[model samples]
Target: MNKVKLKIGEFSQMMQVTVKTLRHYEQMGILKPCEVDQWTGYRYYKLEQMQRLGAIRRLKDIGFSLDEIRELFEEGSHEPNEAQLEEKIKACEEELKVLLKRRENLHQMIDSQRKFKSMEKFSIQSLPEIMVASHREVIKNYQAIGDMCCNVIGPEMQRLGCKCSATGYCFTIEHNKEYKPEDVDIEYCEQVEEMLKDSEIIQFKKMPAVKTALCLKHIGPYDRFYQSYTEMFKYIEEQGYKIVGDLRCVYVDGIWNQDDPEKWLSIIQVPVEK
Candidate 1:
């Protein structure tokens, strides 16, 4: 064979790379033309150079940057070290794990949005006073609400053989002056018709009747309960009422009664002053 030589344009077409990319690779010292015309200053490449261009594209498709591709090409035989390749694979795996978690959170948010469309109508109601067996804690996070309820308080009540009252109004009181996921002050109260022995964490107490509260029925995961809060406050602002006390959330159905998040029911109430 005459050892074919092609102009830069012809070689670019043959290798499926743009002229600009060829010039960039030349500047990056990854790919270079075989000849430059002394008079017209045109660049030319040999047909054999297509193999190098193919290698560049292959490395790029596998997420290698131009610097990495040049280092790969400089590795004597155009084959990367096994250790370096393994490190790259490990980094990619970590990135994939992060992306998977983000995708899961996105789905949860989308599901929450779908559930909010059927929000229940709210009312400003005069809530009656209630007596209860209760446990209060300043927790680290919102999940601690479930942790303290399921692990500590519920088990303790069962151990003591205390039964829920016939009325069965179980609710939580948030005592934080402002909403903060961390360092949350929570009071878990369950109506118990009879008296029971008390621990420092658990006691009997009364939640005073509210003259007026913006209350809404929420049916979904506790994580999505903020939608209820949003709607409740919107109504409160519309009616010209100032928030007077901590938010009150009554749990009608929860993990203790049901396994499905969609089946959980909460009544969110905000005390307001007219």
Candidate 2:
């Protein structure tokens, strides 16, 4: 009986693998043809190589890299070491966590879109003059603003026995003369009943009333604020209105009160003159 040998193409077909994959395996030194015709540079594989190919495919399907497979083959063991298998499991678990977070974010975005489809997007309203307790800081990023308000500013307000206004007006102002990617200069203000003596952390000031402001409701995560800004600017230009003062983002619902970012509502008020 003669031993069966097959060309690279025939072996690839029989093993249900690609010729490219076979070539890669050869380069990786994990699997090589049993013989090569020197003159034509043609490759030939013996029948027994089929078993090795099967093992390689199974390992790869279970998240094993070609390098790992090569190492396993070099150790003269087709089965992975216990430590190697545990490491792969840990990596897979981490990947699963990332995928789960992404899925949750997607669901929040979908719910937000559905709720905002029919809701009013823009409005013009008169803003009343109000006394407010304000705090300013250069924060790491926009996300850190929540923590700064809850932990630092909120405590200072309570210590001073600040009286919050019935209107429940609270907003943030970006004081930076120009845009910044990080270390944002932000001022947080909450409407109060009366002015109080300035503290190291908080200041009392009366905000001027806006005669007419273009308000745009932003629905969803703070990271998506740019979307609302883009629309607001376009609308302002179309209406031939000039923005008079720095924009104020009035927070209605946020991470402090809502678990879902999609449900968070903010009204961007840009003081404008026609």
Candidate 3:
């Protein structure tokens, strides 16, 4: 009986792996051929290397990166040291946490898309003035909107024992001309029965009503608000309306009011000039 050494092509075919992947593994220093012909620079692998290749495939399937794989194999044996195994296991756990968050976000987006396939066109309307408790913050992400509302506005309301207006009118006044999720200068206001004592975090202020504006109702997640805006802006320009003031995003249902993104409803109000 004689041991067989297979060329790269033969090894790839027998291992049921792509040649490209094999080359990548070789470059990553995790795998190498048993012999290379000097004249032609061809790689050859012995039958014994099959077990190592199988181990590499399994490790990849378990979410180990090439760098991690390199570290694992740098021990000169497939038998992983405790520190190596611990590091890989820790990495896998961190990746799983990120994946779970991404999965949840996808579910919210998918659910919202299914809820509203089409958004309503912008309609011109007059907005009435209202007194509100307002706060402005420069935050890193849009999700901070909810955090500020919960931590600042909600607490202020509770501290004052204030009564909310029957209108349920709560909105964020976007100061930026365009949507900038990070470093957003938004003034969030919620209508109240009466103004409470001014606080550094949140203050009672009045929103000067709009005489005319382009308004569109968004009936899904905030992430899908872009869709409504895309359609609304088209309608606005076609109608000959020039935007005059910062946009107002009125929240009818949001994270505070609804658990499912499908139930969220927002109204985008673009103050416009005739």
Candidate 4:
């Protein structure tokens, strides 16, 4: 039986792979010519090399990088390690999640343009530094936040003989670095006339001022906040602003005063810098 061999160009044409790519694969040490002419320095490939090239192309199509492919076959086997393949699958799953979130944000942006074209708008404003009564707690959900304010925090301030500021400025800051549907870590702050002694439930401190804030009006239930958030983030990216401080949600009207959720209004303040 005679062994069949083809020149580099003939092999490249039959495999439908560019000569450059074949040379790159050789440089990467994942694939190499079966024979090299000593005198002429010409490369030759056997028909069996086609199987390896086909496998390499298939793996690349499925998100495997050249380095990963090389590492997989460095042990002199075409079979990939099960653990490494599992890790790749996990990475791809996380990427899919991010892509899905981006798609959802795009749809929300479109919906906001149609539904809140005139009703909601973003404003650049300054937030003044002021004395505030602060209370930090882990709440059950966002909706239950109002209960903590009306029952726990407000009453504590009154008991401590605290005088509310004339402006009645107040806002809630989320301490969470990531979004949570429940078990929310929240810090509530309300402007006051002067600093007072710290109590178990409340502490008086001076909230820092923000020179520039990207403020957006949210008119509806709190659950629909994603719509406003999508618009705000898009605006921030368009304006080339970097978020400098924590976000504050200033409650203008809610179950505390308004009977209807539709009439409730809140302001989202995001501190930013150019």
Best by TM-score: 2
* Per-residue lDDT over 1-274 for candidate 1, one digit per residue giving the tens place of the 0 to 100 score: 5788899999988887899989999999899888899999899898557878877777777668889988877775565678877988998999999999889767866675576556657767887877788988888887667678889888888877778878677788888788786998888898876777887667876678888888888877777777777877788888889988767798887787777666677888788898
| 141: Cα error in model 3, Å | 8.8
List RMSD in Å for every model shown. 4.7, 2.4, 5.3, 11.6
Off by over 4 Å in 3: 1-3, 17-44, 62-76, 79-94, 118-162, 172-213, 219-230, 242-247, 254-264, 270-274
- Model 2, runs deviating above 4 Å: 81-83, 138-141, 220-223, 259-263
Per-model TM-score on C-alpha atoms: 0.69, 0.88, 0.62, 0.57
Which order, best to worst by TM-score?
Answer: 2, 1, 3, 4
Tens digits of per-residue lDDT for model 4, 1-274:
8789889999999999889999999999888999999999899998678889988988887788999889878877676778878988998999999999889767766664555567649889998888999999999999888799889988889899999977678899999889999999999999999888999999889888899999999877788889889989999999999999999999988888976666677899999999
lDDT of 3 by residue, 1-274 (tens): 8679999999999999889988988887888888889999999998668988988878777667778778768867665667867887898899899999899888887766675566545567898888888888787777777778878779877887768888788888777777786898888888888887987777888788889978888887677778888988888788788888878899988888787766788889888986
| 118-157: candidate 2 lDDT, tens digit per residue | 7888899999998999999999988887899889988999
Better structure of 3 and 4 per lDDT: 4
* Per-prediction backbone clash count: 0, 0, 0, 0
Clash pairs, candidate 1, are: none
Better of 1 and 3 by lDDT: 3
What's the ranking of the predictions by lDDT, best on top? 2, 4, 3, 1
Off by over 4 Å in 4: 1-120
lDDT of each: 0.81, 0.92, 0.82, 0.88
